[model samples]
Target: MDSEDLAESVLIHLDVETLIPGTLKHEKCEISTTRKCYSYIKKRTFATFVASKRVSSSPTDTSPVWQCCDETFSDPSSVHKHVSNLHAEEIEQLTTAALDQMLSQSEEAFQKQEDPNESQSDDPASWIPSTSHLSEEELSKGPGEVLLYYSYCQIRDPKLICSWQSELCSRLHLTGKVRVATEGINGTVGGTKTATKLYIKAMLSHPIFKIMQVEDFKTSEGGAECFSELKVGVYKEIVPMGVDPDTISYRLAGTHLEPEQFHKEVQSLLEDASSKNDTILLDCRNFYESKIGQFKNCLAPDIRKFSYFPDYVEKNLDLFRDKKVLMYCTGGIRCERGSAYLRSKNVCKEVYQLKGGIHKYLEQFPEGFYRGKLFVFDDRYAISFNKDIISDCSYCGAPWDQYQLCSTDFCCQLVLSCSSCRQKGLTACCPVCQAKEQRSSSSPSPGRPHREECECTDSRPRIPNDTL
Candidate 1:
């Protein structure tokens, strides 16, 4: 047999039950003491008996010889029997003693290492993740949360806050997007319950965020997995209203109405059909957002992005003229600046905003005027308050509010697709996008399908003066 094959046979026959004494030698922590001992003995025994028998300096020798306890054996079976009968139990006992000593020493070393750290004062800077010891599976199964919040207060250095947020999020093992601007900070982070709680506590302790209370954060079920990655950066605008913050300040935003007050106003509008003629319930979010969950009898714009809201308002100036507008967004951040922009036009009679937006409204009244799932920016896409669905699949006529990013390579449009269509692989947002994707697949190129913007992603006029 070949030398490699002989080595394998010897390893199979070697007695691995007995461990080497820890006092004999040091090995890597990853290598168990018992396994290390067995390895050492197997190497020595195999080299001396097996290798010497088959591969020898003097080509005349072919008999196996195993030496142990001042005696020798010519046959492999005899040597194995002798070791099993005479040495196995004694070796096992010795190894057990060595393991006990090693464990005790390890414990003592660990205590000595921890003593100095324990004596020091507890600081958040030195905080360690509590789930560091948990397995990936355990972390996934554990209770977690996603915090959606925004603060509109002036900051001297937004870059400093941005850097701090990046480091803080990394340390806490959080995953989500955080936009820090000179005006304020807006973020939606997801992590373990402990981590999210710690994040809220840290924010509260910061002087810049003193105006924010626990109520400012709208929390929902889900964890770090809800977000693909952690992105903390500085931006010119917190909510991207596409207007110069210097020109349209949130300080000039419309009057804020509490959830109850806003509910009453909405109920009054819904009860009286003629009241809606003079008063407008404007949804400040994008078409996709309001399409899934919106207040009854509200006007949801067909704008694709938040940046398009200003243009929409500019184009439809007559719609808001002499009308009382009630604006609301996902978490109230958009309405802060959106209302300011609308009021700036001086066309609207009065502009009021939902203090905490749909988030707070649902918290106080889950079965209130708002129906269906609340659209979110995270991987969750949407969180439901009631089973009511107000949107239909873009592909089919079936009612479905769940939004999935268009599968077209470069298209960013979110398509409302029912489970049946999705299962059939109808992921493209529109017919043009689906045709483009198909053409790219059958092309001569061999990489990911080349993609370009389609009509589905382009700007569109506002929806008809009707609530769908």
Candidate 2:
């Protein structure tokens, strides 16, 4: 349908009881059968509508203008028909983008009305400002710390926990992503050292999070500025393995190996060539993450997202049959569930996961078996410890590991381009994306490529031997 009609159709299905001000509601919509639709809209055309036109508080702007070509619809059926006939491919993304813009506008309005000393509202739909009001002196005193940690336990009130986390992080002047769910909490927040210390103290004191210990936190040198902004919300899954948590729970996870123990195991595997045939070092993270850095001779999967891990394992069952396996990720959360899935298959002789993932391992052994940089989910892109460069530039084949978003406006692919190639404007992930960038320069509005055609979405099994 046209942009205006699409927005109208979306608002009608928003299910206001479930749509909160700060969180994007992710329930499926019944509007379409072919695609999974959300109750909100935030995609390209709808986002433009939200930005240019303000929603009236009264009856409504019945004939609001839309960015797409001039069009008028008399009924909902006509709008449905128009949308199905034209924008079928992007229905899911469109709904997701719509929810984001709506939530953003609500957050902005909340900030304007918020009082620093006022008590927080218990309302589920209430939004809190993510930006902190800490003074410059508090934030400028010392080194910063980025904490990575996750806990899996029953949370009776995730919405309440989500609300408290937003306030806590904002008060400490922290930035990064925090996700809370019925299962537990997973977060990576960065801020001043003092603030981070206070945060850990507060978390340990909390009745629900008391199960966490200081050792659970994995810290690195970074500040709130390492991330673009603060984001705290509740979600379906803490790690998003795309499976029911009840079916594959962390309680069924494999043995947790401390840094020293894991080090000895890796050393033995590296020294004994014959052991390689019976032992497997598997990287549970996605292809992009493992590409920059991993333990020497590890088996890194070629999947793009964690949700695909179960499928990858099911298809490659024979690879792990009767073999002793060791798994790891950026932090340890993925392995908690990943190893559980692997063990559920009952194909391995024994399964083990690095207790704190690569973060803790790097702290104990900065120049150890793992090489290159650690890929992070923030504006900093990655954090490095050693001088080794394992991955190469996507364009010129020069040794490099730094990642930059593709220059193509509509593309989300991350490309590894050396400074020389970047200076020459070689930033696209592949030849297909580079051509799209050239075309976008001449057109005012460029259409986004289908996800199936994007290089970032490719799921083919990549040859692991070459990555090492």
Candidate 3:
């Protein structure tokens, strides 16, 4: 048959949608639906007719006597027209080029599916080495890593987000706590580098996080068991600031400054004689967080929990008025609402916040002006940014930064106690609690004592010779 007749016969029998590149499988074909009897060719062989390529008689194309055939066309109609006019002798070469392109695409897709590891090679044909064969010594050598990230965008269904996050973390073998709420998502997780990278990729894969980049994540290195297990749940608020979401919006929060810029601005404000009195560096975190470490000369509120921040702000409104307020929190989530609240009141001349909070700052400047350890919510309790000891033992008044729960069996309050004092049985949060505990232990029980009902129960007890 002539090429034109052969092309027509082929086109009449094939599914047009499947023949076209980048077309959806369910897309309706413009051709008649009744015809479907073409002799099926491999996808690689069919790819040749879809695109044009020049063929040389020699591998190097050094000879001048070679003929070049260009059959490439973009639209399906144009490709059909080119195929119809082409001779059957050219079919073999076209099929070969199309198969090469198909193989390239398949390999590209497979490479994209593989995990990103330093040991991975750029050659698509190279086999991916499995970590399964690595020795236990090699696996246990590196320090574990953790990636802490948060988003302040509105979440329509927090429960759904929580469920997806839980499954994703579990599948990746990650251990951390993630809280999803109407306000947004807050998470602090730790795992092997591969698992953390996969977790980040999975998180950004969600439609809600498409705008966020991987650099937006804050990462820290820790031991393998930094977190005990994965816990994902829906909550009223991501940070529990206690303010109504309607009253504040993160979009209206204070100016966000990067670590270097924040440090410069802070130094400049401190040096300016006039602005020094008019500017206030505010710590938006709880008193316990600031007690372990804080920015130099910052006005950290003396509140136990973030919920009491509103009351603290209301009482100290006079200090904020006509001042340029610089605020920050651990991971910047608290500052998102805290700065917005300050702006809503119209009390400060200007409000600026640390972009990623202390965590980001420490990553950039490990020995910056911030002194002592940064209190964290995990079992690590705190991580040191610098060697500066800014806190003292509550019992003995010696320099100490580690936080330990009160030695009293019933109280859960955390207190700083030097190793010597903790070893000496000074575990109570205060002297009053210590004296009360002694009296209770000395007194004889009238009847069987209920551990839960006992007034002198210590929720956290310090084990001797070990840090709690």
Q: Count the backbone clashes (under 3 Å) in each candidate.
A: 0, 7, 8
- For model 3, the stretches where C-alpha displacement exceeds 4 angstroms are 1-142, 439-468
Between candidates 2 and 3, which one is better according to TM-score?
Answer: 2
Q: Which stretches of candidate 1 lie over 4 Å from their true place?
A: 1-141, 442-453, 462-468
* lDDT (C-alpha) at residue 372 in model 3: 85
Ranking by TM-score: 2, 1, 3
- Determine which window of 10 residues in candidate 3 has minimal summed lDDT: 31-40
For residues 166-195, write the lDDT of model 1, one tens digit per residue. 877877778999999988899999998878
Q: Candidate 2, residue 34: CA error in Å?
A: 41
Q: CA lDDT of each candidate?
A: 0.75, 0.74, 0.66
lDDT tens readout by residue for model 3, 63-124: 31212243334345555445434533345344333334434545555465534223333342
Q: Residue by residue across 208-319, what tens digits does model 2's lDDT show?
A: 6665889999888888888889999898889999888889877667777888999999999999999999899999898889999999999888887889889888888889
- Determine the C-alpha RMSD for candidate 1 after optimal superposition of all C-alphas: 30.7
Range of the 10 consecutive residues with the lowest summed lDDT in candidate 1: 28-37
